[model samples]
Target: MKKYSALLILGILFLILAACGSNDNSESSGGSGDSAPASNGNASSEKENQEEPAITNAIIRVAMKSEVDSLDPYQASATDTGIMMDNVFDGLFDTDENGELIPNLASDYQISEDNLTYTFTLIENATFHNGEDFTAEDVVYSYSRLAGLETGEPLSDKWAVVENVEATGDYEVKVTLKSVDSGFLARTIIAILPEGYEEQETHPIGAGPFKFVDYRPGQSLLLERNDDYYMEDKVPQAAEIEFVLMPDTQTAVLALQAGDIDIIPGVNAQQLMQLDDSVTTLSGPSNMPVIFGLNHAVEPLNDINVRKAINLAIDKDEIINTVMQGSATKIDSNFSPAMAFFYEDSVEGYYETDVEAAKELLAEAGYPDGFDLKMTVPSHATMYTDSAQIIADQLGKANINVTLDPVEWSTWLEQVYTDFNHESTIIGLTGKIDPYDVLIRFVDGYSRNFINYNNAEYNEMIEKAILETDDNERATHYKRAQEILAEDAASVFIMDPDSNTVMRDGVTGLKHYPIGKLNLEDLSITK
Candidate 1:
């Protein structure tokens, strides 16, 4: 076995650990970028004068990438489910148009001097979808379910640091954390539900701008404007919203062209090329990292050499240009470059395309002939399937046989993400404003750690990042954590796919969230 010298290892770490500061309000923090046509701009505008259009319905039809798995806020981890949850549930805090964390359920909050405790004052007159008065108890109940503060069976560690949540007054809730975490506020985006109603999966009740109407399995979901919503000015401009599930991107494109669907919040670059002038696109900032995740618990993938070989065999630029149609920027680390604080430019070219080198590494791992690997891809998103094909082609050059298995969104969620039942998969992980959101998933035993990645050194660095009080020191720890993943080739890091939303010409006021959500609350029709 070869041993790395301490000084040599230190030198490499120093080179990658340079200060990469982040601006609090950078686009990476969250929210959509400027609204401009992603493709042929305003080509469909000419038809606007040609027809009198139908405006009597007052309903905006949206095309979702997949059928929603569950309305239960605790169970949903995918983007499609998050989209629906965004409308049905309101978090204690949410991002503004500029990506800054602002108050939602809690009108104002005060943090302790040590940053370990948070006291929140709820808004008066806020009511739930069922007309129940929203209070501090609801906040405590919702967060308790999310953080498992009281319940032993916690949903996710996304808010694991939350020690306790108690309602001191009718409209006041105080939360105490185990430690001081800078990103804790951003994680507060979890939906606040009524107490004891946490078990409701099929039917979700929350205080938001929209109210659930009906949901048909494998078909569509309908939501209507919540007339009792406290935020009158921000209420839905459209009377109703229908989210139609389109499993295939081609089918979705056809639907958009045929005027059956008014908007597709996220359209890949390849699909963007197919749309004509009639569709308007808003190209915005997205922190979602499309990764070729490998289950470290799996046989061949358990070998670091095999992982590095797989990473080197494929060309990221080629994938970006060909599969993404030059819409995305190649990323070597988990955090996007748009995220100024923890993203390091030096890590951009960590692994280069070296098919022969990859083959040699496989030979070193006792597989000179290479081996067959199955890549489970979710069929709902074209980016996943399209990128999977291109990746399979690239790996083929190194004699690695990749069998592309396309599965439905629900199947992929249960089998691939939740169960860790596959060898490899292609998927995107949406990031939050905080660097913790991106790094915490890679922790040894995190619920969201579907890839089953476990590294002692990585875990140590993350722990330090969480506890570090100094801004520069915290960022340095985050940089080291990313370096560990890159050095180990934790996953085949891919680009942060450009967030592209396609909406018909008649749709007005549609916007995209940087955290990867379509804001329909302010949407309306001009036709």
Candidate 2:
């Protein structure tokens, strides 16, 4: 019996070795088996069971004029910068497809009876890309970091209302404000950073659908989809997203035409008109207002009559038609048409081609001899150059000698904000959802307020409107503020041009936001 058992074990071992050798040979030969029908049948069955593509593997190439400066949302200075950060990082609250504020990181939020306090309840399943669970601590960390109470540069005016933020529970945060701010909800559009986020020096970990893969400064930023994202159902259509930075609009347009890029966000009017039929243009009413900014610190600008003369001198209709190429519409007030309640039609605009009236105002301001003024502008931007030339021509008609000083954007921003080298310049400002945001950034005591146009009464009214809980009263206050700005002629409220985006034929599911963000999550390549 022992001899028989030994023989059987040897036979079993030989069989196992033979099977393994056959399997290895099959793999090596690329599964080419003619002798065994069963093996061939098994191979066919396995091939049929393979899953189809998830539509997430397709990479969508996009073109942008300016490179994303910072991944940190709170520190973003430009619209493109904010858009890039927004894609990889979500805020506690975000606007939905319908342009309404909806919950994002926070499951639900509520305001206190006095409107001075806000409570946010976090979603239990929300987790950062690093697998760290989100909590109220993260919210506190983000807000504090943005307020520059920690490591970031301070945004004093934006954070002035916040008294303190406390983690009342593990997933609940209560923020107590120094005063009631009606614009608090709108301001919460900033991205929420993770707790102890400052520890990360190289990259940031976010709870967004996409993760930052790499960034080549002045070149491009690469992002990949997060497979472990909490909302997998709303997954991005692409496996990877590449933001190739083409600073020059002409070069960007050429690249798009050559099929080197799929989309460009900041294509000017001339570039759009030159695009071939292969690309489709998407445009909408933007919050940005193109205007002529006056340096109130300058001698003549300090005089109301001089400011009014400058405002009356320009022919906005001609500028919009010629320089903007009919892509823009003349706006009477700084407030956008989208802001229905705050935008008062009663606030008259200076659109008429009143060369005679302009001359009259200039002469009335004791400039009958026509004074010479230096106008500084960013050379790269087409709109600024064209507007400056138009204004210079019109001012010449009024006998005002205007010298155009076109400089690079960096140099222009520095001189305009700090040096105050020039008396006036033509520029575009990205409008905010609320009137206070516009007023605070431009008219209030902020860095953008190089114009030095300030009124205690106007400021007080803006403050009241922001803190007022009643919607009707808030609208009334905002209207009054707009009236004050228009009456003073502190800034020339030029055209509010429509934002446009050109895309290739295959790209679909892309949507336009009023804020000018090109959302790519819903986009897919049908071709």
Which candidate comes out best when scored by lDDT?
1
All models: lDDT?
Answer: 0.73, 0.64
Window of ten residues with lowest summed lDDT in model 2: 24-33
Write one digit per residue (lDDT tens) for candidate 2, span 29-69. Answer: 00000010011200111122123433658777777555454
How many angstroms is residue 280 displaced in model 2 relative to the true structure, after the best TM-score fit?
A: 2.6
* Pairs that collide, model 1: 22-341, 31-514, 43-277, 44-277, 44-278
Name the best candidate (by TM-score): 1
Query: Going through the candidates in order, what is the number of backbone clashes in each?
Result: 5, 0
- Pairs clashing in candidate 2? none
Over the stretch 1-527, how does candidate 1's per-residue lDDT look in tens digits? 12222112222122221221111111111111211124322132223443444353488888775666677877766667677668888887766444555667877677777878888778888899988899999988888877876667668776778889999999988889988876676677778898777445877888888888888988898998888888877777778889887756568778888888888766666666788877777664465777899899998999999999999998988877876677676888787776665676778899999999999999999899999999988775566767799999999999899999998767777787678899998877775666777788889988668789999999998888777666678779888888888999999998776666778878766554446556778665776
